[model samples]
Target: AGLSEAGLDLPPMTAEQRRASLELWQRRKAAVLYSVANNLATVAKDHAAAARVYGQLLTLDPGNSERICAALGRLSMQVGDLQSARHHLGRCAQSAPAERRDFYAAQLAVTSADWATAQRLFRSALDSNPGNMLAANNLAVICLYTGQLREAIRLLESLLERQPKLAIHEGLVFNLCTMYDLESSKSVGKKTRLLETVARHRGDNFDVAAFKF
Candidate 1:
């Protein structure tokens, strides 16, 4: 009946032949769905519409692929559909490839204010790949948020030492300055030097009034 509805004639066939035919039909349907979703995403730039089409494709494939979940997760995040983003990104994190999965899921968790999960994911990413500077920086931020100032300082300092160019990173410098101000009574000279260095890097357009010591 389903094949007939799609204008396919049923031929007399063995069980294996019928199974192969159904499989082919399902594959063709999935290809069509993927094409439509790509067109919606690229041509129309309609993230929501593309996400819906991907959701439909997921129903048909049902855990057969993680690419669809990842795409849908990113699209949902772009559209501010946090619930859908969490669901799809969580699925992707569990089933997809390792590269960037934990980082992206942690980011989404941060957006949702699920601080514990974000911290856990960031930490997990760091543990899995100790060279992940982004994960280390994000975890350091969580430590700062929770008032683990010393830990944040240590983490950021380690990062900056490993890549001294990171000293020019505004966020890292800001956090370092804050930590120094809060933890060190003798930080006035150090803070002044840090700000001066930043100002030098930024050149003439840098407004001294914008920075309050």
Candidate 2:
């Protein structure tokens, strides 16, 4: 109304801005649709639908699409679509740059509790960087979860030696003992000594003084 009185109204949309706006809308629309489909498929236990939605999202935004594919593969695995899961994960793994590929692929395998695969990947990561505590810790967890009691203990022990008095070691000791039952774990002389130090609170957390990674 004020514009009319001033003989000045809003100008028509510019072609470039309009085009950009339209593209943005399309991207947002695609994202929303894919998100909705993914949620619905999760609720309905429809891994195929979820995969399709993720595929569409990739089409809409090719950059950073690896995460989307990884998510789709996770759902596919949940629904027993092993083939589809493998296919999507393979694509994501291959498309990822060398630096990021191993982590993503390792994560995918870890999600599925493919401990053997995780072990291999974690080794590769460690070989790449011997001081990668994160990789070492994750490998220890995988071992513990997969019934490799001795291996898990050895991992924690080594880390303790490398970085003693670390609080995370306490948690690791707790998990290992809880998993294997302290008695069974301590049945071995090496394990007994490790657990005794942990239980006695000699150094707190990791007790680096007594061991080396």
For lDDT, the strongest prediction is 1
Summarize candidate 1's per-residue lDDT along 1-213 as a digit string, tens digits. Answer: 634426877667788987887788898998999999999986798998898899898889875658798788778777888888888778777876777688878977876888889889998988887767778888988888887889887886777666655556665676677777777788778777766666655655444433336
- Show where candidate 2 strays beyond 4 Å: 1-11, 34-48, 104-117, 126-141, 149-213
Those runs of model 1 whose alpha carbons end farther than 4 Å from true positions after fitting are 1-9, 97-100, 109-213
Tens digit of per-residue lDDT, candidate 2, span 168-200:
454455554454453263444554666565655
TM-scores vs. true structure, each candidate: 0.49, 0.52
Model 1 has an lDDT value of 0.76
Instruction: Report the Cα lDDT for residue 122, model 2.
Output: 81
For model 1 the local lDDT of residue 131 reads: 63
| Displacement of the residue 145 alpha carbon in candidate 2, Å | 4.8
Q: What lDDT does candidate 1 reach at residue 155?
A: 81
**How does model 1 score by TM-score?**
0.49
Worst 10 residues of 1 by lDDT: 203-212
Which residue pairs collide, candidate 1?
none
